[model samples]
Target: MAAGTGGRGRRWVTAASPVLLPVASAGLVLTLWWGAVVAFDIPRILLPGPAEVVSELIRLRHRLWEQGLVTLTETVVGFGITTVAGLLLGSAIAASRIVDQATTPWLVAFNAVPKVALAPMLVVWLNLGMQPRIAMVVLVSFFPVVLATSAGLRSTPVELVELARSWDASRWRTFAKVRFPYALPQIFMGLKIAMPLALIGAVVGEFAGGNTGLAFVIRTASAGGNTALAFAAIVVLSLMGIGLFYAVVALERLLLPWVRAVTA
Candidate 1:
């Protein structure tokens, strides 16, 4: 029992070490901010102190939660679409050099198009609804997944291919049993990248067209010159992005425990 407790304590200590510097840094920034607010008598419109932001957060907690749900749904739906589409397309391209050659340029072109610029067109085509938001997220996310997974699929060691062939494994068997497993880590890498991109896309779509969400709140707050409220919304958005990113990472760790153990 003592050994188990010691192990957990050590693990906690290890995790805390990495976080300490950031916590200290935040403390310093808040102290300076409070000092500035007092010394300069900074207008709340220009720069609200941390206390005001916290008060606003408490006051608007329920409203923020409702808006957060809308944003979260948009992110999750879009991320799901990108994951399925990317995996399927990546597998297809990886299966055939001809397919890769034919599709690579088109994929590049699609990625090159600035998704933010397409927001207006999306709104026109899909209206100011969840569809446009999800589409934006998918557009922002799919490229990284496809590219990373395809690269991983193609990167199977030649010796591993030869070994599979020596075992008289069919091409499909080789892909299923060998190459795909080898590519799991890279697929997760793409997922990690796409997760945050999905959230950003959703927010951008909301900001450009939607009437609800934290983005809408930010817009209303900024227009009304409620800088504190706008900053609060920004803070919530940042927290959501971070939380989602870590959720993806946790899923990766759970699904690929061997990968984590080996990497660690």
Candidate 2:
């Protein structure tokens, strides 16, 4: 009886841990921040209290929402392109040794390039528009998805391939049935990494002074020394990242119920 109760307790703890830990950590951070603001009587110009940030967020919610949507749109557009292209390139690499060898050097070199430095060039190449921002998102995010997909596809067991061959399954048939399923989990892992990256890329493009999105709002607020408002914009960006990350997670759960059940 005691063992059974302990098992149930462990299960409950495991089930609750994800949500509880983050909430607790955020609460603790906010408490410390509020305490520091009061104890130091910190200048609002340098740092704003949590309350002030919240108030500013509320005051600017509409404008923030509009800007946020722009960021989200660019992020999604760019990320979608990244995912599709990554899957194609990854499949090619995984399927062909020659293709992998040929592409590796270029992929490594491109990945090594500091994407922030490309913002000005991207703007110059694409002109001063969301096109550059979306391109920025793709550049920053494409590598992970490609690497993950290639790894996952290549990781399919040799025995599975042999068995498929014995059964007279074509290469496409085997990949569709066996390889793709195995790759889904890793692809989603890449996606989680890519999603936040896409958002950051959008902001980076905006920092080049394109005049839209939360990045633009943040730049304006900071230039005017509205630290509270700037902090508020940052808060919105964090929420956006959190929201996007969880959305991908939820989609993963929905699509891969067996993966979730196995992991749990």
Candidate 3:
């Protein structure tokens, strides 16, 4: 009876762990934050408590949503550009060492520069509109996709190449059947990495003095000395980042069943 009871208890834990763990973790974090605010008597200007932040978020929900939607739109547009352009460029570079040698330095150089420093130039070049925002997103997020997809293409097994050659496959056939599909895991890796970077790019673009976006909200709130509102904007930004990252993850799971088998 004791053995059966223990087995049932173990099964119950297994069932409950996924839901329980995150809830417990969030609860612990909130408790610590609330305790710190009360113990330190921290002023709202320096740092607002959870309650204050939540209240501010609720009070300004409509404005936050409107601005957040603009940010989200820019992020998505930029990510889309990164995806299409990166794949083409990565494939070309992977297929030809000459192309890789010619382009790799420029890509690395651009990435090495501070994105913030470039934001103003982008705004000037693309204009202080969604064009600049999308351009920044593409710049910030493209390198990872290009590099990872290139690496994955290069990493295709020699045996697989030999097999395709033996079967008298065309270059396009070999790629369509093997290279592109096999590279998806690495591609997805780049995408997941790029998602948050895209958000940052959008925010940076907004910092160049745009009229809409979460970054603008943050700046305006801070300037007005409404720290609670700034924190509220930051909370919205965090949620956007988390939501986008998981969206890519979900896409990976849906498209790549083999990842599960390979990892398993």
Candidate 4:
């Protein structure tokens, strides 16, 4: 009975650790931040204390919500576009040597260029609208999906391919049964990477030129020397990024329960 109880307790702890650990770590960080601000007499302009930032968050909650929605919409839309385009392109490259040879160099070269440099150009071409922001997100987030998908598809075991062929499976059947499943882990990895990149891309576009978004809030607040408000905006962005990342992780676990079991 005692052993069973102990086992259940351990399982409970394990289950709760994901939530508890982050909360504990955040508490510790906030405590340290508060202590440092109090000890050093840091000016609010230089570094607002956690309390001040929280207060600012409360003050601007509604505005922040609206801006956050705009940013989130841009990120989701852009990531959706990236996922579709990247998968199609990656699959083509992986399946055809001609496509791979023709496109790989260009992809490498384009990815090498700083995305920040492209943001202004997008704004110039598309104007200071949501189109440029979405475009920036696509440009920033598309490469990882393509890279991961192609690599994963290409890395499907030779034996598996042969086994599928031996069974007289059609090309599509083989891919659906074997290659795509094997590639899902990598594809999801690309998606996880792209989610944050999409958020960053939206922010970069906003910084380059925009009157909305959390990034815009941060930019305007900092420019106006409302350091606490800027910090508040940053906090909101951090929360948004964390939420999106975990959503991807949850989807991955849902689709690839076996992967999680193996890793665990």
Candidate number achieving the greatest lDDT relative to the actual structure? 4
Clashing pairs in 2: none
In model 1, state the lDDT of residue 175.
Answer: 94
lDDT of 2 at 10: 99
C-alpha TM-scores of all predictions: 0.90, 0.93, 0.94, 0.97
Candidate 2 residue lDDT tens string, 62-175: 999999999899999999999999999999999999999999789999999999999999999999879999999999999999999999999998999899999999999999
Q: Which lDDT value does model 3 have at 181?
A: 88
Clashes of each: 0, 0, 0, 0
Worst 10 residues of 2 by lDDT: 255-264
In candidate 3 the C-alpha lDDT for residue 11 amounts to: 100
- The window of 10 residues in a row where model 3 has the poorest summed lDDT is 121-130
Better of 3 and 4 by TM-score: 4
Ranking by TM-score: 4, 3, 2, 1
Query: Which regions of candidate 4 fall more than 4 Å away from where they truly are?
Result: 262-264
**Model 3 stretches astray by more than 4 angstroms:** 1-19
| Residue 26 alpha-carbon offset, candidate 4, angstroms | 0.4
**What TM-score does prediction 3 earn?**
0.94
Which candidate do you rate higher for lDDT, 1 or 2?
Answer: 2
Ranking by lDDT: 4, 2, 3, 1
lDDT of all the models against the reference? 0.92, 0.93, 0.92, 0.95
- In angstroms, the error of model 2 at 123 is 0.9
Query: For residues 1-264, could you state the per-residue lDDT of candidate 4 as single tens digits?
Result: 999999999999999999999999999999999999999999989999999999999999999999999999999999999999999999999999999999999999999999999888999999987999999999999999999999999999999999999999999999899999999999999999999999999999999998989999999999899999999999999999999999999999998999977764
